[model samples]
Target: MPRRSGGLRSGTHYKLRIKSRDKGAHNIAKQLQDFKKEDIVMIRTIANCHSGMPNSRFLGKQGKIVGKKGRCYAVSVLDGSKAKIVVAHPVHLQKLGGLAVQISKTNEGVV
Candidate 1:
């Protein structure tokens, strides 16, 4: 497949550092640390997909979000096929906890 202008590279997308979600002089950082071990999360899409699929599809897949090279979430979207997707950050995704896939990532605001 050809490289899309904004598409992510396989290896380049797997070197991101997880952001610190903490409160000064508190144990909140420890709680946030546990979230990283989660295998899957529910999130929504903040970017436009040129694929022409419905918006629900992006939010409905059980993709793996890993901290990649660019500090992007290497999302493995499972829509009939497995796509190694990369999002700029994980915080962009809204954690649904149980059975709701509605993660959202910011494509313009942050780097």
Candidate 2:
């Protein structure tokens, strides 16, 4: 069967699955990689990452997709505790679900 882009499915909930070459795409925040611009993703919550640097202030939170800024993705997160916009890389995401909001085909000039 052909692959579908939007809506819900039984397989991966991400926009796209990472290939073998994309394994290391999600290792750390600094060495983060993969994922294209505007790609909606789900970042795994850092449970035990509450100390030092940015993590010291904002850990254990699920970030939201806003957009990208340079190599880092601008994220707006609300861990059910606090909400803020932070810059993160693709490696920080695990592709849990699709964006609740999808771009309209008409807006994209599709017919």
Residue 99 C-alpha lDDT in model 2: 37
TM-score of each: 0.36, 0.38
- lDDT of each prediction vs. the true structure? 0.40, 0.46
Global lDDT for candidate 2?
Answer: 0.46
lDDT of 2 by residue, 54-93 (tens): 3323333444457777766776655444556767555455
lDDT of 1 by residue, 10-100 (tens): 3333232223552234333322322353346544433322221223345544555555534345555555544545453443344445443
Query: How many clashes show up per model?
Result: 11, 0
Give the C-alpha miss distance for residue 33 in model 1, angstroms.
Answer: 10
Q: Give the TM-score (vs. native) of candidate 2.
A: 0.38
Error of 2 at 23 (Å): 13
